[model samples]
Target chain A: SAVISQKPSRDICQRGTSLTIQCQVDSQVTMMFWYRQQPGQSLTLIATANQGSEATYESGFVIDKFPISRPNLTFSTLTVSNMSPEDSSIYLCSVSQRADPTGELFFGEGSRLTVL
Target chain B: QQQVKQSPQSLIVQKGGISIINCAYENTAFDYFPWYQQFPGKGPALLIAIRPDVSEKKEGRFTISFNKSAKQFSLHIMDSQPGDSATYFCAAAPSGGYNKLIFGAGTRLAVHP
Candidate 1:
């Protein structure tokens, strides 16, 4: 298992404000992903943040609304832009140590956000 | 479109009983199936996983039964304990790609002592 840490475990922000959640892993990894869990919903892949490429957004997610940064193998950040009440959810960061074909994900303690 | 569907949105079990959660997927391209356990306010942790080649895989008290033809898989927890009470999620990933997982709705399990 990998040790993952996220900043500001929980936060409350007003509508139209943006919040950035940071994730750090003890070991270096190739693929870092950001997922969002809406209230009472399952986790949804927001984007895939690779070391040296643009993050790939999922179907319903866009980079403009949910931008992701993978500065290095061990660190990544997810920014929720132009937030609204519906944007309030738990943001999780996960990493895969092995190659893409066969790898398991290890997640961090999610960042819980509450929008007013 | 929901890729993976989970059943019994929630479950209750007695200590020492077996707790079972089932999930089904639509895409045959998904070859890897993994189950995750999550406590309140915490990120999901990988419990166990299986590939299409195997019918079943077990790790300690946790077991995953996969059915290739049926496109379904299930998790069975033997001797369920109070400590095992949490939300369980079943996810599937494509065989080759970035390995993005499509998660199930999740099942909240409660074990009575």
Candidate 2:
């Protein structure tokens, strides 16, 4: 198991503003992923942040809207750009251990953003 | 072909009763199945998981039944309690690329005491 810490647990921002959420892991991990959870919905994979490469984004998400930065194996950041009312959601940070073959994930508490 | 469909969008169960949630996947490449539980104002936590190689996996009060031929799986919560009232999500992923998970629409469970 891993312990992940996220900054700005809850924030209220005006439309058109941008916010950067930070994720810090207790130990190094092989894979780091970001997820989004809308109100009363399931978790959606936004992107997979690579240590030194560009993040791999999923369908319906782009780097322009959500820029990711993974400086090292234990730290990463996600910037929600040009926010709108629809951007209000809980952003989560998760990680998978290198030794685990089953790929069990450990999640953070999540940063809740409310775009007004 | 990458979708995981879940049933019973919401459920109400009495304490000490069984709470069952079912899920089906369309992709045969998906060999890893996991269940997540989320409480209000909290992130989703991995509850239990099962692989297609086994028919069922049990962990304490939670059990997972897998049917590879049917492309289906289900979660059983025995002696459900009020503390278990939360949103549950089912996810599927391929063997090597385990981080790329396709999550199903969550099920909201209410275990009343």
Highest-TM-score candidate: 2
lDDT for each residue of candidate 1 in B48-69, tens digit (9 for 90 to 100): 9898999999999999999899
Q: Model 1: clashing residue pairs?
A: none
Which candidate leads in DockQ? 1
TM-score of 2: 0.97
Question: Lowest summed lDDT over 10 consecutive residues: which window, candidate 2 chain B?
Answer: B94-103
Give the alpha carbon lDDT tens digit for every residue of B1-113 in model 2: 98899989999999999999999999999999999999998878999988899999999999999999999999999999999999999999998877777899999999999
Query: Which 10-residue span in candidate 2 chain A carries the lowest summed lDDT?
Result: A97-106
lDDT of 1 at B78: 100
Candidate 2, which segments miss by more than 4 Å at Cα?
Answer: A99-101
Q: What is the C-alpha lDDT of each candidate?
A: 0.90, 0.93
